[model samples]
Target chain A: MTRGRGFFPIIRSWSIAAVAALAVLAGPAAVPALAKDYSHIVIATEGAYPPYNMHAPDGKLIGFEIDLGNNLCARMHITCTWIAQDWDSMIPALNAGKFDAIMDGMSVTPQRLKVIDFSIPYTQSPTTFLVLKSSPLAKMPDTGKRVSLDDDAAMKAAIAAITPALKGKTVGVQVATIQYNLLHTYLRNVVTIRTYKTTEEHDLDLASDRIDAAIASTSYFVSTLNKPGGNQFVEVGPLFTGGLLGKGTGVGIRKSDPELVAMFNQAIEAAKKDGTIRALSLKWFKTDISPPN
Target chain B: MNTSNPFVLLGFGPNGWGASLVAGAAMTLAVSIAAYLVGLVFGGLAAWARIAGPRPARRLVGLYTTVFRGIPELLVIYLVYFGGSEALTSLGHLFGRSGFIGLDGFLAGTLAVGLIAGAYQTEALRGGFLAIPRGEIEAARAVGMGRLLMLRRVIAPRALRFALPGMGNVWQQVLKESALISVTGLSELMRAVNVASDSTRLPFDFGIAGFALYLVLTSFSGGVFRNAERSLARHERAR
Candidate 1:
């Protein structure tokens, strides 16, 4: 009788385990599968990227890209939900179907184009260096000038001019960003490059004097410079654009989703033509970053 | 107080993050409890298998515990977040469903933390069962008590008495592990603090707030476990 009773629980336990295993396997199917026709979409962004994207104190997402994305979604006549994702894994997560689209200030570049598709450029901002106001590098050469990296002679001269002030100094850039690639391509040998997970982290390091300089998009710096104690920092050196830095920021979608690419491209064109992008840029970034025709 | 004041920054004002922080703490608690229950299910099964199963079943449980315990918690989270979705998508394809099947952040975090906690839980429960005196089990057999009756009247209660302390440790570990789930983008306590600090550029204030919230959760749970242990010990003290 005891053996029989013992056998009952063993069978019960095994059956319970089997049932649980089946439930987990079936749970994903219960999620309504996506239809090919696009009606509802999910978009991912790095909420830590302020001005472009950041969470309001109320836990609401608000920023330049958030406004632009909503505008574009409305034009396309689709409902969208925004999800906050870490920047490093944004592309991989997009492909994995964690979200259908990415609007995280991701720029369009040749290397990125190889793995994913991007909409036509939406916002264009030049990359530059930021340094402490009291630092000698604050007076870096051609401080207010724009130098297109597509121009070989100008790019070479710009690098040469800044090398003296920057050489042997520690410079910070966000990891996996076009700005990191820019530093690697132009000044890797001259400076000790440090990478951070977020642009904000580099800003903190710069404020603490842990690094001599930090580099990022000028529009991003606009937010940094407006914050408390932001006056202690100043933009320096030539504003670099084009070439390896990519055309501008765009909506990143999976290579498998050409339809999404088309939808975003059309909506972006509408926003640009009607000056919605310009209005949002001026409101959030204090400057217009709408891509030119 | 000025805007720069820590109290003002953490207060429930228009610009303050007190409400969000509390919500995040609540999310952390929800995730921990769900994961702990999942761990108990898996751990109970594995422990039973180790105690009285065939050789191959024992070996399988052994492998499950070893692999989960050996990995870094973050890597385990990444695997469950990405790999769980990948596996589910493949399974969906087998049933003729197309497109990707993604696991949301909450589910992924729960599974990852549960699996890790399950490994430790298995050891604790097995130790509990083993610590049950063989003489008592034999005495139950001598009294003609059936296996189910013996388990209810003698075995389970005693084993639980031994397991309570170890299970409490597992519970605390699960609470801490829930913070790592932020990478999956579930806005738990740690992630909430991170976002608030980064957004406001005041890490110190938000950090302290987060630190206090975690302390309250852990200490509150610790007190509950202590009470449970004392209650479970009451009958023995009456002897």
Candidate 2:
């Protein structure tokens, strides 16, 4: 979900982009010397999305990724304390040195990679639609088919297939998300796209019929889609990934820290090889979300 | 339905978020107080520069007030958090230093909000100084008081009386702006509401609680301001 700074919260589109661009250009920062030891590093997460990173009733952060993140740090011999940062500031905060890294469900989009580096994706849950089951669009064409945005003709064919169903409809998505971007790219001419700061806000609005449909990661939807009174909405539309949707969720880090990147990369590799990622994925998501090798 | 149970959801009782929310509000109070002091330092200097300095110095202070007040508050914070170090590092190398100097989130936030608040405070203080009777300053001059004595004896006390209400409004503004510091991962009132909402998935209850808490902070300060105004004005009888 897109969370950020502001009084009115005007989407943080300009200031964040401009500053992040400037930071990238400003060259090396003054940081403590890179050490061989891995005694401490602060990691951040949004704690808004579930089964990835969300807080338990006692305010303890609990989820599949939290468990795996701690396991990775242990393997790397690093002591880590997690901070729950708002999603919209995760990149800026990381770059600002508020935290050393981010473990939020941040997709590895090319646009994001321009500003921050990522570990190889730990989860690649494809994007899909959640709509009221009573809606006529429930039978939306190409349901269950995986549509990669890189496939030009096939992508167009799928877009054309669902165009009429989405026309004049109001669709909800978390602000600044790839799902929001896709709405602008493919469906802007057809529907009104409403953006929320969190997936849960949109989910609540969806249940109250404030919007006709919403699109988010299937894994995120899984966290709440079937919670009580959630039976009304059914997952619809072709699952999407690639191109604007990017590779999948990864740990966001500053580009200058190749050591941290390499460390996380090895940890993710070890987790995958040992089936730790898959087990945590299944335990939390009821599905395997570990990225394909 | 899981979010419907208000007391258990919002309470600090083991499962409730009662503790975190209180702590977050306390953080908001802490940052706002620090930022207010920063503004006091900047505003005092800027107001003095504007009122007594040479023409060029006055123009520079004028420009400072205009630019900071003109841009939106959020942009100022972004510049502080993201752009501050980047600019500092480059500015560093220009003077022959290498490496990075990172600003902590709380520092960045306090400076940004305080910097903006200082712009308004400068104008308020300047107005307060102008309101002082010019004859009083001449009398101070005739009595052979030096600049510092005049400032401490005649100017400071009077201007402070006039400036309290305006500074009170500025205080409220700073308190509200403290919520924006949440972007830098400084846990405060707004961030607390967000975390609580996401945690409980019940935005309304948390939203109401947040609104009430802000009201308490604002109205509590308003009461203090009113009392301050009365106490400061006590010397002036009803003529």
Best by lDDT: 1
Q: Model 2, residue A30: what's the lDDT?
A: 22
> What Cα-based lDDT does every candidate model obtain?
0.86, 0.80
Model 2 DockQ vs. reference: 0.37
Per-model TM-score versus the true fold: 0.93, 0.87
Report clash pairs, candidate 2: A29-B100, A30-B99, A30-B100
Candidate 2 lDDT by residue in tens digits, A163-229: 9888899999998788988999998998899999888888888877889999999999898765656
| lDDT, residue B61, model 1 | 95
In model 2, what lDDT does residue A242 have?
A: 89
Q: For candidate 2, lDDT tens digit of each residue in B12-125?
A: 777687787887788788778878888887898999999999999899999999999999998999898888867755664574543333555566777799899999999999
lDDT of prediction 2: 0.80
Per-residue alpha-carbon lDDT of candidate 1 for residues A114-204, written as tens digits (9 for 90 to 100) = 9889999999999999999999998898897999999999999999999998989999999999999999999999999999988998999
Task: Give, for candidate 2 chain B, the lowest lDDT window spanning 10 residues.
Answer: B95-104
Structural similarity of chain A in candidate 1, as TM-score: 0.90
TM-score of 1: 0.93
